[model samples]
Target: MTPGLLVQSQGRVLPVGLSVLSTRGKRELELPDRGLVVGAVRPGSPAARAALRPGTREEAFRGGVIVLGGDVITAADRQLVDAFEDLQSVLIDRKEGDPVTLTVVRGGQTRTVQLTLDASAFRVQGR
Candidate 1:
């Protein structure tokens, strides 16, 4: 079994990269962008300590009616970013402290600018 492709327990082959996760008993707080929206920046953290917030959303209600509330991310270095995964994919290839320009839409206005990357909230852990 040294070169075995799997280890079976109770007749079930254990999958690679398998780990137990608790979706139960977890308080799921819904944020604007599938909980990926940056609501509040921690003081003295890489973001707040630096200066970044959830980019504002552009594209007005087109009337009194409205739709999604999350900030609309327009672009990353001239590349269009239309979804949350797009932003995540870009960040994955980057490292902390890397400088980047993000085009954000807020209140129907679009602005392009740069920001330094920081460790995501998920990566930072309490001692």
Candidate 2:
């Protein structure tokens, strides 16, 4: 299947409503690539409803060192996520309001969060 930013839900292609920046882009923003920094989150979107903030960084740390980013997405309804594309791929097939579990690193601590998907028009940029 082709990888893209849009997902099919309820017979319509919709945006997942998350603004994710790559780890490399994070470096340019002066934020350590602790994880993929959520550059911007659509207001009232699934991610926003899930309490995911724009500056939130999703990563895993051990012994005070970053081990990985964009590689730890695990939804309750899906398998392990190896990349951002994998995560998006899963989202595409799921309906809005589907529940997902995310393991993220924030404030030097690892936390598990639950999220629901939201549908929106297409957006090309994270910010």
Candidate 3:
């Protein structure tokens, strides 16, 4: 089925449900900013449904944390992430149907979004 169709049948998915590259990879590729770069988004995935675009920098932001050249990801739920791995580790521990709150900086503006984890047909590799 098409990704969109799958999402319609399901609901908001989590872990942002997108294929991402590390910020270091982004820099090596000479891409824009040094942040997690969204590479591909699964069809019917929450990331796809949420309109997270490929090539966008993933950043976590808050008052005391400084992200040099990328967007800031402030928090996930009530937990603050010191690094990308911190966020990934937390998501890894969560199960489908769990809820997550994400604070992100996009276009120099901050937005808080809520998402629900969904079961994917394929498991995330190398988790």
Candidate 4:
């Protein structure tokens, strides 16, 4: 799929379904770490379908708390993800049903997992 698909569908949207944070910025905002952290995984989304895990611990951030220590996304499709935008840029041109390989670190163990983007995972608000 492409952005044209989004234009054609109007309210349909494709999403990874994971609340991801750039640990490089998170060091000052949340963790004293640097990497991409999975804060939460949306149920039934691609991330969830891939069995992705979220952080283990919870801490206050911006007056709200979210999971920490779950999984660190080091890369996607063999491309380095040093920031949230890095991942965004890599996936911007991708569409639903596109296959992706993710490098995830959990409990200090690194592993790769397969994922496929899904447009049905979400919709435009108020649609």
lDDT of 2 by residue, 5-83 (tens): 2344566643322234356644553333333334345676666677764543424222111222222222334444434
Better of 1 and 2 by lDDT: 2
Q: Lowest summed-lDDT stretch of 10 residues in model 1?
A: 17-26
Model 1 Cα lDDT, one tens digit per residue, 1-127: 0001123457554311101212331112112121223333456554454354542332222121112233334566666554444555666778877876766554445666576766662263321
> What's each prediction's clash count?
4, 0, 11, 1
Per-model TM-score versus the true fold: 0.45, 0.48, 0.48, 0.63
For model 1, the stretches where C-alpha displacement exceeds 4 angstroms are 1-70, 121-127
Best by lDDT: 4
Show where candidate 4 strays beyond 4 Å.
1-33, 60-66, 120-127
Model 1 lDDT, residue 98, Cα: 85
lDDT of 4 by residue, 8-79 (tens): 134453322223334554654434343466766778778888888876565544323445667767788998
Global CA lDDT computed for model 3:
0.45
Model 2 residue 78 distance off true place after TM-score fit, in angstroms: 7.2
lDDT of 3 at 104: 54
Report residue 50 deviation for candidate 3 (angstroms): 2.9
Candidate 2's error at 43, in angstroms? 1.1
In model 2, the runs with Cα more than 4 Å from the true position are 1-35, 56-82, 121-127
* Full-model lDDT for every candidate: 0.40, 0.45, 0.45, 0.59
